[model samples]
Target: MNYNLKYYKFGLAIMAVILTFLSCKDKVKNKVSNEEAAISTFTNPLKVEFGDPFVLDNGDGTFYMYGTGQVENGFATYSSNDLVNWKFEGRIYEGNIEASWTQKNFWAPEVYKFGAKYFLFFSADDKDNPNDELENFKIGVAVSDSPKGPFKDLTDQPLFDPGYPIIDANVFKDDDGKFYLYYSRVCYKHPVESEISQWAKEEGLYDEIEESWVYGVELAADFKSVIGEPQLLLRPPLEMNDRNAEWESRSVTSGEVNRRWTEGSFTFKHNGTYYMMYSANHYAGPNYAVGYATSNSPLGKYQKADNNPVLQKNIDKGGDVTGTGHNMVLSLNGGKKMYTMYHGRTKAMGENRVVFIDKMNIEEDGTLIVDGPTTESIPKPLEN
Candidate 1:
């Protein structure tokens, strides 16, 4: 039977099986290594000048980010899967003279998925009233079938002008299936004789400065109309409380008199509590910063978080980061982790701003934490 010959053949078969198994294992290991490498190396100032950045996840593993730009006709967007690499999606809304009341000053567009449609809320100057001297900015809504949208205006006018200027519209949907809109009521024509203005004038800080305030209101199901009176959410602190007065007062220090801003409101619910984040000071100045408030309900008698200015420029650390504000928060890894997307200026770039995403955490005491305004590279969000 040639027993030695049979044993030799058996040995060759066993060696072949082991070699095949090793080859498969190497392939799998290399594939995983490549994926990890791709996911970990995201740089800051994400490749685009996205002022007042708003990022929306379509529940389809894709993210679309919108912000202020010089799109003479409409608004634009950028899309990404990994949140690190972005591709421009072009102008998603071009003003229709026949259907739109506004023709210029388009800024800060944010999109949300509602029912079977995606709604885009944005700010622009109303062109309807020629005699109006302010040329006031107002928020309006448009709709599309896809997240990457060429949205059509839902109506021919602004969503319900509060008899004054309003801008930076943000929409939030609560667990009870109700929708709310948060926005900035700009202080353009408001009396400069107010207490804050007087204090500034007396200090020689600068005069004729009015402050922007954050406001919120419930929206009808169609999102085309406001359901109730607007509720004031936040305003710049007139008195310096802790470090808030110093941080939020950067505009005054930077020579932008009467320019305390509390605009760009974004809302998210975590652990049954509602968090509202808003930006302060002039957007173009280095003093721009972000702060938050908390309440039990969406339309809150919300109180400002004592740990105010949760995100701001880190100039004391001595890097090229400044003017950090106008942030949007997104839940990642099935709501286990969160990230804040915002805009900031680098020393090399001056007033020019670029988009950034950084880790956001909630503390045990319900204080919201933003681990950045960082200039260093960071890891991308977990893939769905």
Candidate 2:
């Protein structure tokens, strides 16, 4: 073969590849409009109805929000360029379809852009209730090629059930390239002998009380399974005298229900301190609220913040917002600003969960604070 002829053919092939790359880049630019209509401010109960709202800030300057109650037996997504306006993206993951392993009561869908693909971690009941248990909730994973997804489950099974119901899956990737799966074990069948339980029985509200606890485990590289046993990360205090216990047991003490929740956990590291933010109390009730704990490691002996219930219903303080929990932190503009994406209820719209985005920050003393559950119009999330 002539050397000149071979070199000419190689050069032609390289030019074809470059042209294809530029063509695709142009298409990407046209795909997202990037919110030409600027928004200087936004109000609470963002026009989108979502319980347990999770916002994913894709590196390409667009954000996608996913949550519960937006779809039936599955999940839906909303896309946004500015944090103020959102466009419904329709159902991304639907369970209960033929051969689907998960079914009704879908909740808390958190998506992450891992490598070239987006992965969604969510929870729902088992489609096949082989045991016929009352609550058969479990965590499941789905994958998509885009942030606005047609995400399909990776397998026809729940992601490694811990012999009980679990929900509110949050996947975290550490600096070491290891993945960690954090979730809340359901209150179902998890009865414990605690002051709250005894008080519930004494008050004749219920014979026994169940409490949800949060757990964390190292996820396998492929995300197909767990690397080891789940470690108990956080749970409601067994002692009523505990500081956080008071806020956490409002459901039982208020005589609304007979359960305590330590669910809706969102963990992230800020300034070398691993902060795990979690919710407590019944999610559908007024007492549902958020708190945080800090640890030196991803999974460890965590200490709850002195400012317990950092974000709670302002009703007691003469405001309308309630049911503010299941929070996922949104880091925008390359982490220059941070906000909490959670669900809440207004006095006029009781029991109907809606989304709330509020600023959160760390104090000089390292206290994690969520200045949220606000009702009035607030300055929109900082895009820069």
Candidate 3:
């Protein structure tokens, strides 16, 4: 055989081998991409009636969710691996106590896992003396051995002392792993001639005149009790008033100025800023809405979002959404996806509120913008 001819044949063989390897690599890449898309795209399997999301990542590709699960006077639990599709995990705790303080009306239940135990925090009022237990109205926690737990009362008594009227308990651990509990409390005074004053005499809101303020308590190393006083973090705007339009009964407040006060205190840090989202207006009324404030620190001197409320609607004006507020924020797939869970009433005569989850995004200024929830199914996180 001619040496030049043999060398040319060998070079051609090398080129063919290189082309084959490149083609195989491209096929593998395409396969992996398709697999990822399949995993990320998921169907919304959650059928919770109202929103007050309780989401936890259980590490094994499984995430647990507890959506407005109030079981027999105590909050319930539900689990999910994907952002969508949930399984009822059963009631985690039983509520009992005759303080004439935390009697009923179980509000928001926020849970956190600290070390080997699960701490469940929630709000309630014994309609007989709501404001009397101001500090007790704040947050309470129960501990359990497992994520899906029969959490037992840690203190065997109220975890917080009743001094300020607080509700909507949210527990967060910072990047450095320090534990803190954030919540909303009424810090403003009720109008002397308002119904609240009249109700105060009979029991309900207003045992004392105080406005709603969001505060953060530094938790002990065990994530149990407060180390110091819950710092005065955010206060409701001094100028808040019933901004309800005239057409809508002054008898029924609406619009912007109607004594807007913060209720739900949900905190999340993004882009080095702490954002607190809260609820306003009468929880049982159609005017219920959500607003947010931002600050540079978790324990903050929060500045109200220049835009005020990030979510609201005028169902009184012939709209679909009504009474949407009291929300919790959750992150999925290790922060690739964010969601807003909250509760809203669907009918005029009904207080049977239901929970809804919607996709949300953060603006450049550290404010959140939510798309709101719909009956239509949405894609899941890891499965998308």
Compared with the true structure, all predictions reach lDDT values of 0.83, 0.87, 0.64
Find the 10 residues in a row with the least total lDDT in model 2.
Answer: 31-40
lDDT value for candidate 3?
A: 0.64
What TM value does model 2 have? Answer: 0.88
- Please write out the lDDT profile of model 2 over residues 1-384, one tens digit for every residue: 699999999999999999999999988776544333234556788888888898888877788899887777788999988877899999898788886788788888899998899898988888768889999998998899988778989888888978999998999889999999999999998898898888788878999988899999999988899988999989899888898889988998899887889999999988888999999998888889999999999988788988998999898888889888989888766667888888999977777888888888788899878887787767778633
Candidate 1 Cα RMSD (Å): 5.9
lDDT of 1 by residue, 1-384 (tens): 699999999999999999999999999999999878767766688888879888888888898988898367678988988887899988889884777888678888998887789899999988876666565788999999987788999988889988888899998888888889899888786543445556678888766677788888999988778997998878776665444667777777657666777888899998999999988888887778889989998888788888878888788778778889899998887888899999999877778889988999998889889998877756777642
Residue 236 of candidate 2: its Cα lDDT?
90
Best by lDDT: 2
Off by over 4 Å in 2: 1-39
lDDT of 3 by residue, 217-311 (tens): 88777645788778877654332242322211221233323343557778888877878888766666666777777887778777767665666
Q: Considering lDDT, which of the candidate structures 1 and 3 is the better prediction for this target?
A: 1
Which pairs clash (backbone N, Cα, C closer than 3 Å) in model 2? none
Worst lDDT 10-window in candidate 3? 244-253
Q: Which stretches of candidate 3 lie over 4 Å from their true place?
A: 1-46, 67-70, 97-103, 125-138, 186-210, 240-252, 255-260, 314-319, 347-350
